[model samples]
Target: MPTGLALRDPRQQLFDAAERVLVRDGPTGLTSRAVTTEAGVAKGVLHRYFADFDAFLTGLVLDRIARVKAQATALGETAGTGTVADNLTSALMTSFDPVMVSIVALIIARDELRTRLRTAGTARFPLVGEGSAMIAGYLTAERELGRIAPDADIDTVAPTLIGAAHLLFTERKDSPPEPEAVRKVVTTVLAGAMR
Candidate 1:
């Protein structure tokens, strides 16, 4: 019998390395060589796992989306355990991390990669849409717990918060917003909805 979990997933390791390269060097620096070097694997490792660089890029974006979605789900799980502002701020911060920002930049700058992502059935890259839904779900749970106004329009509030945070993260590419700034945005967006 194997002791603990002996087998490791190479794909996850590669994805982590790719993320490091992306955060440190931006989209332009995310070549196969760079990814492999960062991962401590041969250049052929990525190609073996993915069809090509475009495939790898798409996989990375999708992986990140899934991760954010999982986090959103967890937020719903603990709806009433923490302050609404704190919870919202944590969710927004996770979405706007440096690696995620770099991936967004990569998708925008590389037309080929974008085409590949579209072909993968993410034409609009529904990260924001999915995130909005998660936020709405969390808000609904909070409202049920008497944490928010009974009449709060959750649908509208969710998108407003997501859109503002997305814009703030994208616009401030060089200087990511501070925690206070994110908190301010969260507070502002939640004012009408929160009790």
Candidate 2:
């Protein structure tokens, strides 16, 4: 960008650019220079907004966590209204979508970023942990409504679903797994839980 040029929302611009770099290059290709270049801003701009690259990454993952929390609220609203399998499938598809899957990979690859995230007060593995919470919350609501067995261990089931969805998305690479594939995993995982 031109020197002294103004951006309406530099943070969001940088974030969106970071996501694009992550998608195209995977974790190895992500760097402060890459993000700034992708954002069309000076490298100094990133430092201005964040303490370091890890801080910037923390911002990105935390932003995503907020999105997952919002998704959780929306998923909670659907608890008793849809088939449990269908609701879970929908949640998995959106919760672990392409960008999110990549973000998870990015998080796993950066030790410093992980430490920084913890320092920033997000000790959980951001995307995966938050996504699991979303699933668990929905399942808990379902159980309360008698849609699922009262004995269902949602804490275990939630992370299992997130892991399976992450695997499907990661292995598929070129495309997202079909809804049927996700549905099958959901139904299978929850078979003992669904009443």
RMSD (CA, Å), candidate 2 to true, equals 1.1
Expressed as tens digits, the lDDT of each residue in 1-195 for candidate 2 is 565989899999999999999999999998999999999999999999999888899999999888999999999999889698998899888887778988999999999888877777773886788888899999999999999899999989999988888888899888898999999999999988988
- Count: clashes, candidate 1: 0
In model 2, which residue pairs have backbone atoms overlapping below 3 Å?
Answer: none
Clashing pairs in model 1, backbone N/Cα/C closer than 3 A? none
Q: Residue by residue across 86-158, what tens digits does model 1's lDDT show?
A: 9999888877787777777787888887777677766275466677878999999999999999999998999
TM, every model:
0.83, 0.96
CA lDDT scores, all candidates in order: 0.83, 0.89
